[model samples]
Target: MELNQVYFWTNTIKDWKRLLQPDKYKHVILQSWQELVSRGVVCIYGFVIMPNHLHIVWEMLEPNGKEIPHASFNKFTSHTILADLKQHHPQVLPFFSVDDSDRLHRVWQRDPLAILMDGQEKVEQKIEYMHRNPLHERWNLVDSPENYRWSSAPFYETGLDEWGILTHYKDRF
Candidate 1:
């Protein structure tokens, strides 16, 4: 088996579903991300949630000297996100349901595209790329990178980390 120290992930929904068909849904997803980081389950390296998908750069930290397996974290986050979405708004029921195969609710794509990040350069580059996604030619939600609050752009711009979870990137910001 291959071993990697760091990984980049790109996970999407089935059929490119746009249940984040609106802005509030996206905000809720962002909030969930912040909550996870605050609890110390992971570090928020970078992230951008688009209308239909999201891009994130993060590190799953070991707990009490125990390594956090990537697959398990992803599954946990998937469940948490779905549960929160369902609890906050009953509107999500039309899109997702329990899967018979695994006997669990499946919402995200089966697997994510993971690229191991080994060096500082790769890490920095991925961070920049994630920030740029919200400004693609088709997307005009912001005039500048920092204007997008869904991302860590604001902290990078002002160094005023409204969310405590950004401590790891304070220097970079």
Candidate 2:
């Protein structure tokens, strides 16, 4: 939550819907991260965009206007994805609908899991976990971690920032 401090953050879609299974939705998440990075609000060290959730090891470089960078990301991506779904997949919108008074559609669940990374060991562990997520038997998204296009494994393994939003954890250390 504080500037320059690393955290392992996990955010899941409401009802665990596989909304991010589509490439377009995944890109929306990436674009949100890129926007925050461009505005100097966050520096992503590692990330994996899963079908229904996302994991990130990042530093909060600064606040996004009055709100924290994570809050801005949640708000921006939710609104954008919700709008897209409304226009193209209105039937799917009901799955994210809420009965409470806080707006209508809720893309992400409340209180995302954020574990503060106090040392390099913990950071490395989380980075490994994130990279291997897509390779898990349940997902089987890729044979190799680096093969997953939505993860930062390629950057760590081959020293390539294909997505342009990653800040090598070694560099940060």
Candidate 3:
């Protein structure tokens, strides 16, 4: 959580719902990432947006305003996705329902996993793991990792920032 520390993070949707199967929801995630980068809160090195989860390797440049970048991302995307569900997919709203005192809807599970990328080897290993996630037997989202549009594999393979949200990890080294 310290500034400038690189982490390989994984965030799962509440109850692992497939809410992000739609491109619109994934776009919201991309927009949040772009905003954080633009605001100098984080520098994304690699990422993959799955149907129910997301994984990324990023450096926390600074806190997003008063909160950490991850908190800002969760809050923003949850609010946006909640609103979208309330309108077009009311039935889906209950999937995120929470009976706790704080709030009603919970888009993301609490306490996401973040492993410090302490060395270049660790960083490269995580980036590869993230890129190949879509090709996992359980998901099989793409025949090849590079074909998955929601991941940084294409960027790493072709040296193109199709999403315009990537900062090469080597640059920081």
Error of 2 at 37 (Å): 0.7
Off by over 4 Å in 1: 1-4, 21-23, 63-100, 168-173
Candidate 2 whole-model C-alpha lDDT, 0 to 1: 0.93
lDDT of 2 at 122: 95
lDDT of 3 by residue, 1-173 (tens): 67889999999999998999999999999999999988988999999999999999998898877898988999999999999999999998888999989999999998999999988899999999999999999999999989999999999999999878999889976
Residue pairs in steric clash, candidate 3?
A: none
What is the TM-score ranking, best to worst?
3, 2, 1
Q: Compared with the true structure, what per-residue lDDT tens digits does model 1 show for residues 1-173? A: 02324456787765577765567656566666566666666666667777667777666664413435445445555666677777986686556666578745566776778787767788778878878877888877777788887776777678777655564343333
lDDT of the candidates, in the order given: 0.65, 0.93, 0.93
lDDT accuracy of residue 108 in candidate 2:
96
lDDT of 1 at 153: 71
| Candidate 2 local lDDT, 1-173, one digit each (tens) | 77778999999999888999999999999999989988888999999999999999999988889999999999999999999999999999999999878798899999999999998899999999999999999999999999999999998889998778988888877
TM-score of each candidate structure, all chains considered together: 0.72, 0.97, 0.98
Q: What local lDDT does model 2 show for residue 7?
A: 96
